[model samples]
Target: MLLQDKVVLITGGSQGIGAGAALGCAEHGAHVAINYHGNSADAEKVVAEVRKKGRRAIAVKGDVADASTATAFVKAAVQEFGKVDVFVSNAGICPFHSFLDMPQETLERTLKVNLHGAYYMTQAAANQMKDQGHGGSIVAISSISALVGGEYQTHYTPTKAGVHSLMQSCAIALGRYGIRCNSVMPGTIATSINKEDLAQPGKREYMEGRIPLGRLGRPDDVAGCVVFLASDLARYVTGASVLVDGGLFVNLQ
Candidate 1:
C-alpha cells in the first residue's frame, strides 16, 4: 500500500513493461490510467485486471509521440482521477539497424517517440501536479543502452540517453515544487520489442550468458523499481537513474 490512493498515468501501458507498471501501481492501491496508442483490446484487458483487484483503472487511447494526443491523454486522466500523483513515460520504439545502414525515417521516429514523447507527457503531467499543490513523481523507462551503446541499436541508444538527461534536468527544475523525476534503465528485458532477436535458438542463451543474473530481465523487474520511485519510500531520491540490468552494464569491460 505504498501508493495507496495515488493516481498514476502510464503511457504505452497496454503491454510489456508499461502494462506491468500499471498492474503494479494498481496492486499498491493506486488508481491507474493506462494509455495505449493502438490495441484498445489489450488496454481494456489491463483495465479489467486492475478493476478486478479492487482498484480503479481506465484505458486511454492516444499517441504520446504527438503533443496534442499526449496533452489530451493527461487531461483525460486528470478529469477522471482529480490529479496525477505519478506519471510514467514508458512509450517508446526500437527498430534496430546498423549505424551505417540506418534509415533517416527510422531514426527520426525513434527520437520522436522515445524522447519527444516523454518530454511532452512530463510537461503536461507536471503542470497538472503543480496546480494540485501536492507535487508528484515522474518516471521514464530508459534502457541500459543509454549507459553502454549497443552495436545494432544506434538510434535507440541516443533516445534513451536523451531520456536520462531529461530526467536529470526535470528533477532539478521541479524539485522546488516537490516534484521528483527519475529514470529506470533496463537491460535485455523479455518484451515483444526484442522478440525477433530472441527468437533465434542460440540468441537467448548468448544474452543470458552475458548477464551476471544468468537470465534475461522480466517486465516486473523494471516495474518494481518504478513503483518504488513513485512511492513515498523514495521521497528523498530524485535526479537518479536506477539500473535494472542484472549487472550487464557493470560487467561489460
Candidate 2:
C-alpha cells in the first residue's frame, strides 16, 4: 500500500506496460486516470480492473502527439480526483525500420508521439503540481534502447534517449517545487509493440539468450518499478533512470 490514497495519471494506458502500471498503482490504493489513444474497449477494461481494486478509475481518450491533449488529460484527472500526485509518461510508438530507408513520416511520427508527447504531458503535469504546491512524481517509460541500439530501431532509440534525458533535466527544473522526475528503462519487453518482431524466426530466442535472466520482460516486471517510483518509497529519488531490464544491460557488454 505504498501509494495509499494517491491520485495517479497514466498516458497510453490501454494495454501493455501502461495498463499494467495502472493496475499496479490501483493495487497500492491509488485512484487512477488512464489515457488511451484509440481502443476504448481495452481502456475501459483497464478502468474496470482498477475499480475492482476498490479505487476510482477513468479512461481518457486522446492522442498524446497533440500538445493540447496533455493539458486536457491533467484537467480531466483533477476534475475527477481533486488533485494529481503522480504522472507516468508511457504513451509511445515504435515502427521498426532500417536507418538508410526510413520514411520521413515514420521518423516524424515517432518523434512527435514519443518525445514530444512526453514533453507536453510532463510540462502539463508539472504545471498542475506546481500550482497545487505539494509537488509530485513524473516517471517516463524509457527503454534499454536508450542505452544501446537496434538495427531496426534507428528512429525509435533516439526518442527513448530523449525521454530519459527529459526526466533528468526536468528533475532539476522542477526540484524547487518538490516534484521529482525519473525514468524506467525496460529491456526486450514482450508486448504488442514487438509481437510481430519477436515472432520472426529465432528472434525471440536470440533476445532471451542475450539476457542473463534467461527470459524476456513482462509488463508487470516494469510496472512494479513504476509503482515504486510513484510511491513515497522513492520520495528522495529524482533525476534518475532505473533499469527494469533483468540485467540485460550488463549482459550486453
By TM-score, who's the top model here?
2
Badly placed stretches (over 4 Å) of model 1 are none
Q: Rate the local accuracy (lDDT) of all candidates.
A: 0.92, 0.96
Q: Write the per-residue lDDT of candidate 1 for residues 1-253, one digit (tens) a residue.
A: 9899999999999999999999999889999998898888999999999999899988888877789977898888888988899999999989878899789999989989999999999999998888888989999998898988788898999899999999999999999999999999999999988999899999999999999999999999998999999999999999999999899988896
Residues 107-131, candidate 2: write the lDDT tens digits.
9999999999999999999999999
On lDDT, the leading prediction is 2
Cα deviation of 252 in candidate 2 (Å)? Answer: 0.4
lDDT of 2: 0.96
Query: RMSD of each candidate?
Result: 0.8, 0.6
Each prediction's total of clashing residue pairs, residues at least 3 apart in sequence or on different chains, is 0, 0
